[model samples]
Target: MKSLKFLIILPALFLSNLFAQATILNTIAADPESGIYLTAADYKNNQLHLAGNLSTNNKLRLNDFLGSRTLTISHKGQNHEFSKDSIYGYRDKAGNDYRLYKSYSTPYKILENGKIVIYEIKQPGHKQNGFKPLVCYYFSEGADGEIYLLSLDNLKKSFKDQPAFDSIDANFQTDYDLIKYDNYHHMFRINRVLAKL
Candidate 1:
């Protein structure tokens, strides 16, 4: 009887957590406004008026690569289209910041925004391996800086000049440690290194 109750409780907890995550995503996706960051300066200043304020009717479909990989916005009465390469990036209805870092077909999601920005992108995985998608993490020095793979070596190279650089080596023994998120602080563990510096 006890075993039966434990099994039921475990599944209940799992479903509860899954549903909570779904709820959060739905709420974020429901935002009615979208903003476009025209340049790195605009992104830094939180100014989104390059192509004028955008409505979230269609929002942004980063995966849309039908013709020239463009982002079309409707403002006032006319329609304005901006190419991925022309603009810095935009915030979707879900309030997620995506960048055309590598000028890829799909924009990379900005996970953490700060002096050192963290980005994540997903790609299709091998077919034989159950088609599990591949997720890659990258980091950039600043909004306009070049992006590098999120590796311990790259982290060290990017911020070697920081006074707290030694702490990175002391605390993070593996690459995973560099990308670990601190739920308590709501930021990446690596950001702590920047917080001190």
Candidate 2:
């Protein structure tokens, strides 16, 4: 009886402690190179769980560790949230329930200057030649609010050729007020009182 009780209580106990929302006062980083905080389930299962947004050197960068999922997007006055851990995607007003959009799978950096830099990690399966694109997503509150898709392969090789881009990844330096899509990033700022559960 005690053993069964322990098993039943274990999950509840673990989840009970986390009843509160993640009140991370940390500045958000696109992805924390420092590392992401893992839950016990994620740690034990060796699963990549989403660690909210990351904070690097006082800058706010969006972060989602479980590949790319669970980030909420306000699309056309409707709250489009990712329920399952799938590639960050969305459909039109009336479309499929799930699918892959042309979004970079890594964390996105929201610069202060309205530059959204998305980092796409090249796994073993997908590799365009020797270089992977740092898919840049540019957005702002003003004229540059739409998502601008720029590729590192295109930006650097504009005056050069794709063959010369024989690198593994691209390193991007971004800031909060200097972020590309911060105008949109601010859309995520939660300032209210509620229960997470």
Backbone clash total for model 2 is 22
Give Cα distance to truth, residue 177, candidate 1, Å.
Answer: 1.2
Q: Which tens-of-lDDT digit does each residue in 11-93 have in candidate 1? A: 99999999999999977666545667888888888776533323425444454756456777655555668777888888765
lDDT of 2 by residue, 1-197 (tens): 99999999999987866653333322222233221223323322324323222221222123357564455544223443454334333222221112223353543343222122222222343366455543434332221233333444333343144422332122222222212222453531111000110
> Please, what is the TM-score per model?
0.74, 0.20
Model 2, position 83: C-alpha lDDT score? 40
lDDT of 1 at 112: 89
Maximum-TM-score candidate: 1
